[model samples]
Target: MDIATGAGLLAGLTVVVTIILMGGDLKAFYDTHALIVIGGGCLASTLIRFPFVAIVHGLPLGLKFAFTMRSTTSRDLVDELARLAEVARKQGPVGLEKVDTDDAFLAKGIRYVADGYDMDFIRDNLERDRDNFLMHLDEGQKIYRAIGDCAPAFGMIGTLIGMVQMFSNMSDPSKLGPFMAVALLATLYGALVANLFCLPIADKLHVKLADEETNRTLIIDGILMIRDSKSPTLVREMLLAYLPEKHRHEEGEPVPA
Candidate 1:
């Protein structure tokens, strides 16, 4: 699980709820008309911008990525590649078939090498797979961003409608409170929905997209190095370049225990 995503979401919701409860009755904040305005507008706007498939598939995919952690880290991939390099040197490409990896992209590359595929073919397929995966992440990011963008505009619309209604009722003191409630409530709903949910998830997905691209690229390089029959130490050093500077080890360092 992604602790940061989960923790951040939970903390935001907790603070919101606590503030609401401390202020007054939470039920007073609820208005069916306000909800319909914000919810309906966001949904309609999103549909206008994206296909239904994006809502059906993209939303769940985005949520899944937000809540889950990547199975393999770049450092782990370097270590795994180094080990596989030794196997390739001693037992040849066939030895790679016995290896296991947590990363699906790395596994696919390993399969290609073990099957005696050409290096160009391996690189092309890996790059295609990486691009396709990144494209989906991009779609998810855009969908949520659209929703976040639409919400506030719709809230303002609803508030304006409420104000118009409130003004029309100026002669009658009785109906002002209800109309004003709709106005205030719509804004509240929009702010909460955009800030607490859609926008944050969109930003998180953007971060995920970048990390995935980096990791997949790193895996591709490591896989090709293994295919070339590079020495284990050399592969280790080369793959270490893909990691952040702080994570890279120095030359002639003691071997990991």
Candidate 2:
């Protein structure tokens, strides 16, 4: 699991709960009408903006990515690719067939080399796949951002409705408190949902997308090097450039030919 995402969510909730408890009358915050207006309207507006399929599928997937730990990192990909390059150099492209890999992208690239695909064919296909995946991630991000933007507007609408009701019922002093609660609580719920959930998740998804793209690009480079029969040491050196300077120096020196 992603500790940062989990921790951030826990911390935010803790703070919100603490403030509510300290203020007393915690039950006052709950308004069924406010929830229906803000939450329901936000969902309706978001569905209008994005495909229903994307909203239904993308949200859970995006949240899973944000909350779950990634199976691999960029450094792991670099090291694995370097090893594959070494195997290819020693035993040729056919050797890669015996190499077991959990990563589908890496496996596909190796298969292409073993199948004698030209450089252009390999590069074009891989780039297209990467672009398509990135486009989907972009759509997911936009969906979350749209929810964040629409939520506050719905909250304001709820507030206006509450005000209208409150004014119309001004003759009855008993109704004023409930109407005011609806107006204020709707705004609170909207702000909380947007800032603590939607916006943050959208930002996290963007980070995940960038990280995935970087790893995929690294794998592509490694596969191309293996296809060209580059030495393992050279492959290691080339891929190492993708890391920070500190990490670059930490890698073992290239093996002597």
Best by lDDT: 1
Q: Please give, for residues 110-135, the per-residue lDDT of candidate 2 as tens digits.
A: 89998889999999999898887777
TM-score of 1: 0.91
Task: Name the lDDT of candidate 2.
Answer: 0.85
Per-residue lDDT value at 39 in model 1: 91
Assess every candidate by TM-score: 0.91, 0.89
Worst 10 contiguous positions by lDDT, candidate 2: 248-257
The TM-score of predicted model 2 comes to 0.89
Please list the C-alpha lDDT of all candidates, in the order they appear.
0.88, 0.85
lDDT per residue for candidate 1 within 1-257, as digits (tens), equals 99998898899989988998998978888899899999999988988899887677788888889889998877877888889999999999999999988777888999999999999999999999999888878888889888888888899988998999999999999999889999999988898888888899999999999989988998898889888888999989987877877678655665455
How far is each candidate from the true structure, as Cα RMSD in Å? 3.0, 3.3
